[model samples]
Target: MRRKLAAGNWKMNGLVDDLSEIKALTEAHPDPDVDMLICAPATLIAQMAWARGTHALQIGGQTCHAERSGAHTGDISAPMLRDAGASHVLVGHSERRTDHGETDADVAGQAAAAHAAGLVAVICIGETLDQRESGHALTVITDQLRGSLPPGATAANTVIAYEPVWAIGTGKVPTTEQIGEVHGTLRATLRDLMKQAEGVRLLYGGSVKGSNAGEIFAVADVDGALVGGASLKAADFSPIVSALENA
Candidate 1:
């Protein structure tokens, strides 16, 4: 069975002062049954790791450069994130794809870099509102999986997150059925592509919160969530963790 993961992407948010929220989260679930992680902004990754102390709370980077080290100005590399105590790094988040125009091959490169640095690569794939409405959501996401996954990815070092573009931060969530269909398709796609597919965790993102987490977690093949806005606070995020544990 795949271990459930409740991962948060602080996404261009949080500072040194914000470390307390993670601290509180560790305190709330000192011995959580499921894994807990926060992918903070680059500036706060090291500090958050320090704040987590001896707790099981994991710290990660929102994104990392495809290259281990390069002349690329303003880019953080995977090795750097690992050096700062991050055990994982997000690759190909929708915002990054939209804002930076990252292609699937670019994401594959980044994932490879993360693997080289001994960090888990949470590879994100999703569809826009138009694609879903046009009945191409599954095709789009599957294509992304085929194109974005690195050459050497395995269940232990890779995770997949599906976040519908329209649902993120929009207070809109895909119905449980919609989530199930996507996750099911993703699982099949992984099975066809990798020998370790069944052990890989599949997480649903986009407007995930405590109120909806239980139902979402109930879906088949949904190992957990890649929470966004709701993850910034302990009161909001703890319940989601609880829901996953009970799920």
Candidate 2:
């Protein structure tokens, strides 16, 4: 069975002082049944890692460069993230795709780099509201998945997060049936494309929170969530973790 994960993306947020939230999170779920992670900003990664201390709460980076090093002024490479105590890094987040024009091939290269550096890559793929309304959501999502995943990707080093672009940070969510449809298609696609597909975890994102987490967790093939705004606080996130644990 795939292990449930409650992963948070702090995005461009978090600071040294924000590490106290991690303390509270680890305290709340000292022996959590599910895996917990927080991907903070580049500036606070090392400090967040230090703050987590001996707790099982994992630390990660929001995004990483495809190349290992050199010339990219503001880009953090996967190896650099690993050096700073990050065991995982997000690739192909929607914000990066829109704000930086990150193509699927570019995301694939980034995921490959993360794997080479021995960090798990939380590869994200999703469609827009327009695509869903036009009856092309499945095709768009499948095509993105096919193009964004690297040849070296495996269940152990890769996790897939499906976050619809229109729903992220907008207090909107796809119905549970909508989530199930996408995740089911993703699982089927992975089975045809990889050797260890069944073991790979599929996480639903976009407007995920404590209030709706239990219902979301009950969806088939929804192994966990890639939470956004609600993940910023322990009180908000802990119940989601608990819901996953109970699920």
Any residue pairs clashing in model 2, and if so which? none
lDDT of 2 by residue, 1-247 (tens): 8999999999877778888899999999999999998989989988889998899998899989999999999889999999999999999998999999999999999999999999999999999999999999999999999999999889999999999999999999999999999999999999989999999999999999989999999999999999998889999999999999999
TM-score of each: 0.99, 0.99
lDDT of 1 by residue, 66-116 (tens): 888979999999999999999999999999999999999999999999999
Note the Cα lDDT for every prediction shown.
0.95, 0.94
